[model samples]
Target: MRELTFENVTVRFGSRRRGTVAVDDVSLRVPAGQVVGLVGESGSGKSTLARAAVGLAPLASGRISPAPHERHVQMVFQDPYSALDPRMSVGESIAEAGRRAVDVAGLLELVGLPGDRAGDRPHLLSGGQRQRVALARALAGDPEVIIADEITSALDVSIQGAVLNVVRELQRRMNLTMLFISHNLAVVRYVSDIVAVMKDGRIVEYGPVDEVLGDPRHEYTRELLAAVPRPAH
Candidate 1:
């Protein structure tokens, strides 16, 4: 597994003079073979950072180590339906992103999907299954690091757990280094070893998931934790 690093990275949009900064001088790391969860509310720059990591969003300044190359870093986008082509069968999509001599069936089975479902089109699968296909496609690239941007936010609550289970299992089985971005604290807490809380366009607090969530030092982190709904006794 390879580690991902961001050094004072900044991403801007539009003209330099008038453009807004989507990610502002942010620095973080996803250690090799570890899951780093990035949590923040809407427009907090979490997704922008993920995009910048994958070379989708251009950076105005600073640098990202190992560079933004598709072979090393792959992203599993939130909306699998839109991410995959409607005309292409599941096998074709995975093969397209993968290197030569790819195991399309094995990749499908790895994500808990049947090997025979390769011929099925994206529209025929449920939201959760499409997301699994997306995961398989990402794995086909043989990437050391994966940037999952709110991957489960688009799915139904009942199906969310199943997809997340696949992710957790894959991470353990493959020792995949990941940047799991989500707005849900519970989900982050469940999957992440380290947690980073972002507010506005910067990370305000970051540490081990237990420490950061259990005893938050930053006000924003505390507020986010407090916002999680608790079950009645």
Candidate 2:
């Protein structure tokens, strides 16, 4: 188990004077073998942070330990349809990211996908299945840290739980360190050991999952909690 850390991380787009700061001096940690959920509304820099971790976004300042070149990190993107290649079979895609002689079937099974589905192309799978395939590919690389960036947002509500279950189960079974990013407080509460609330480009509140959710200190967090759908008796 490897702990992932961000030290005063920042990200910007376009020119320095004219560019917008997507993430601002954000420092958070995902402890080894634990899940840290990053929750915020859209345009809150949640996705940008994830992208920076995976080296997809250029960092203007600060550092992310276990850099992408070290191959200790892998990211599962939000859009399942676009995450995988249209031309490659799911198995091939997994193999492409994996070290030599990867067990494509086993990785599929790890994500609750059948071994036989390996031959299916991205178009042949349902949205949930494609997301599962993406998860499998991430695992094939044997990453120490996994960044799940709003992975369930694009899926049907009925299937979101299924995907989340796979994620939580895998994290526990593998003792994986993960950063689970989402806008849904309920979803974050369901899977996180710790929670960080972001508004604008900075984290406004962060603490243990139950503490932060049950007794939020930040006004933004309270508003987000209020927006959550309460169960009907």
Candidate 3:
């Protein structure tokens, strides 16, 4: 397991004068073997931070350090369909992560899919199954840290719960360090050990899931919590 660290990170888009600041002076630490949830509304810069962690976005300043054994951090994106190749078999897609030594069957089983499903293509599977395959592919490289960016947003509630369960179990059993990015506070509370609430490109509140979500000090955090739909008992 490896820890991911972001020290005084900043990311800007376009020109310095005409550009937008996606992430502003952000400092975060995702310790090894723990899940850190980054939550915010659209354009709040949580996704940019996740992208920076995975080396997908250029940081205007600061540093991102991946775990020692990981060649690179892997990301499980929001749209598995777009992330995966339609022509490739699920097994082949997983093997693309360059872990040929890990058998396809093992990879499938690791993500809660049957071993025999490896030969199936992305189009042949349900959205949840495709996302699981995406997870398997992300795991193929044995990454020290996995960045999951709004992975459950596209799935139905039932499927989302199942997927979250798979992810939670995997994190525990594999001791995988993870950064789970989402706009939903409820989902973040369900899966995260620590939660960071973002607003206007900066973290407004961060702490243990219960403490931050239960007793939000920031006004933005309070508004976010109040926005979540609650079930009537």
Candidate 4:
């Protein structure tokens, strides 16, 4: 069965002075337990599409069918610091997953955070720690799908690896269907089984990661590959 899908989705916003179509007509699907990377430059409707997939963004036209409640879609934002609350300590923030808001020490441990760090606020924790907490909170709902929108962009190289590993493990262990949205090609390639490239608010090219990344068919996709900086071994 299909885990998540967007059919001919269109999102348009008409403000007081102007109107814009953030997400053009887009249709996508991710099978259960597969990770599909939505690769695009900023404003290419990556986040907008991510939100739409999870029913956060109202679809102006077309259809969005989320799986049943037990198989609901979940989102993981890019900025862990911004996504988390400063008023609550890391433990308290994670504890929100509980029905009555009990301690989340076990949750912290699951995300690789020390139990002692539970009392620290977002400001005190490192970029990686905050993200771990975010992961714990998002998983608190026990979602079937997790939308990670450039969640590691704000972290250091070392921290990026840590967060990505956690996501990868969770996907494997839980058989999660995920939409990993990012501007970073390397990161996308690392986590995705398949990739779809978006341009001008539409997916112009898509295929298996090896095929798309190894031999890009689209001009924009080739350009994206060329712009990537490689490290000399």
Q: State the weakest 10-residue window (summed lDDT) of model 4.
A: 65-74
| lDDT (10s digit) by residue, model 4, range 1-233 | 23777889888878625878888899888778899999989899989988877667777888876732343666889887788888988777777765455557777777777778888889998888888888888777667778899999999997799889988987787778888999999999999999999987888998999999999999999999998998999
How many clashes does the backbone of model 2 have?
0
lDDT score, candidate 4: 0.83
Off by over 4 Å in 3: 67-70
Which has the greatest lDDT? 2
Model 2: per-residue Cα lDDT at residue 19? 96
List the candidate 2 regions with Cα displacement exceeding 4 Å. none
Residues 1-233, candidate 2: write the lDDT tens digits: 89999999999998999999999999998899999999999999999999999899989999999886798999999999999999999999999998778999999999999899999989989999999999999998989999999999999999999999999999999999999999999899999999999999999998999999999999999999999888999
lDDT of each: 0.94, 0.95, 0.90, 0.83
Local accuracy of candidate 3 as per-residue lDDT tens digits, 1-233: 88889899999999999999999999998889999999999999988898888777898999889732346688999986798999998889888886557777987898899999988888999999999999999899878889999999999888999999999999999999999999998889889999998899998888999999888899999999899998999
- Cα error, residue 155 of model 4, in Å, equals 0.8
Q: In model 4, what is the error at residue 122, expressed in angstroms?
A: 2.0
Candidate 4 regions with alpha-carbon error over 4 angstroms: 15-18, 67-71, 98-103
By lDDT, the better pick of 2 and 4 is: 2
- Estimate the TM-score for candidate 1: 0.98
- Clashing residue pairs found in predicted model 1: none
Error of 1 at 138 (Å): 0.2
Error of 2 at 80 (Å): 0.5
Q: Which lDDT tens digits does candidate 1 get at residues 1-233?
A: 99999999999999989999888999999999999999999999999999888888999998986588646999999997799999999999999998777899999999999999999999899999999999999999889899999999999999999999999999999999999999999999999999999998999999999999999999999899889999999
